[model samples]
Target: MNAVGVDVGGTKIAAGVVTPEGKILDEVRYPTPHSPGTLVETIARAITEVGDAPEVGGVCLAVPGLVLAQENKVVYSPNLRAVEGIPLKDELEPKIGMPLTVENDGNAAAWGEFRFGVGSEADHLVFVTLGTGIGGGVITHGILMRGAQGSGGELGHVTIQATGPRCACGNHGCLEALASGTAIGRRARELAVEHPDSALGRLAARRQILGEDVTELAREGDEVALSVLDEAGRWLGVGLAGFINIFNPEVVAVGGGVMEAEELVLEAARKEVILRARPPSRDLADVKVATLGPKSGVLGAAALARDASSREYLLGG
Candidate 1:
């Protein structure tokens, strides 16, 4: 079967026609609009463009915010402020002329990974996307754990340091503040300024050094970059240790732009978790990099549509 999946990010809206096996057939992209109405229209247009084929079953939207699944509204999203409280499902269903499902982008990604990626073998899983900020999703017993308010798995917001750096959410020392890609880049840039003779400095001179640049530089034997990554990895490990203790999931899948330095990042994180987390929980949970990469969000959205349809069929039967 075919479905359209829309990934609504802060900067762009990407929609694709996907097969049941998670292969994308066709995709369309557009810059995200600043206004709520324009944004909805943009999404609708993209969905229509991608889902015009006769075989398309439905459309699924992956949104980066506190998604109220019951009402199909985005309750709170700092990145997409204009869309807060908008009735996304009600608006997009008629526009696309098909059944529709909406879910948190991270949750969609978790389900995607469960259905088609590395987590396919695991019944209980947690997916952490360490991008501009951190996003998380949890799956238990083959079901997505969207809490009562549809905002349960805000893992990044978990406090790592009681009196640490301030976060955008008005919290102290959130995992996002300490270990996210943006945090890693910001720290690398700061260190680059101090170590002008370092390779990191040279990379920064050519262009703004991103988190992946730091990891690549570190692999090439740059001390400053390695130091920064190691520090970030340790912080990530601390957070993951807590997660392991609490949930004891079967697998922890890490993704996002920063994960390009898989070994550099995961090794340090693994070391910390191994040292800190409870023995059996850490051992039982296999930590791996997300195999789906950037396509995860769209694929996850498509998976959401697929799963929803399957449930409907079962219920009707």
Candidate 2:
């Protein structure tokens, strides 16, 4: 069977046809629109394009923020201002003419990794995407954990410092405030300004220095970039340590653009987790990088639809 997976992100909308084996067949992409209506229309177009294929069974949408399952409404999305309370499934299902499922993008990505990627070997899994901010998902006993209000597993918002920098969420000292890709980029830019002679500064002079550039600089042994990544990784570890105590997942899969820094980031994060997390929990969890890359969200969304269809068929019989 096959499903169409839509990854509705802040900057882009990626849709793909995914088989039961978790392979993405054909894909389409478009820049995310400004308004809710346009966004939905864009998604509908992508689904139509992908579902034109013969084997497509359903559509799965991976959305950022809290989605109310009962109403299929996106309760709040920090990145997309126009999407709040929108009946996403109701709007898209008819347009696409297929059974549809909506999931938190992080949850979908985590499930994808669990079923097809790095976390497949572990029953308890946590996936943290270190993008502009951190997005997390947890799966225990092979089921997604959405919490009571469908707002659970928000690891990025977990407070690491009581009196730290202000977050976009209006909170102080949230993990996102300290360890997000945006935070990393912002800090790198600041350091570049301070140390105008730094190699990173030279790169920033030509164009806006991105988080990836910082990672590259660190890889090339630039001290400023290395220090920035270490600080960010330390904070990441601090947040994961708390999660380790609470969830005790068997595996923690880290992905996102920041993971490009590889050892530079992971080493510091590991150090912090070892120092802060409960010894048993820390020892139990194996931290690894996700292998699916940018396709994780779409692949996971498709998996959600495929799993839901199988379960429905089983129960119906």
Could you estimate the TM-score for every candidate? 0.93, 0.94
lDDT of 1 by residue, 203-286 (tens): 888889888788888999999999999999999999999998988899999998889888788889999999999978989988
The local distance difference test score of model 1 is 0.88
| Full-model lDDT for every candidate | 0.88, 0.87
Residues 1-317, candidate 2: write the lDDT tens digits. 89888899999999999998888889999999979889889999999998898788988888988877657677888898777877888898889899887888888888889888989888788889999878989988777888886677787888999999898888999999999899999899999998888998888788888888898899899999999999999999998888888889999999988898877888899899999999788999888799898899999999888888787423421
Candidate 1: the clashing residue pairs are none
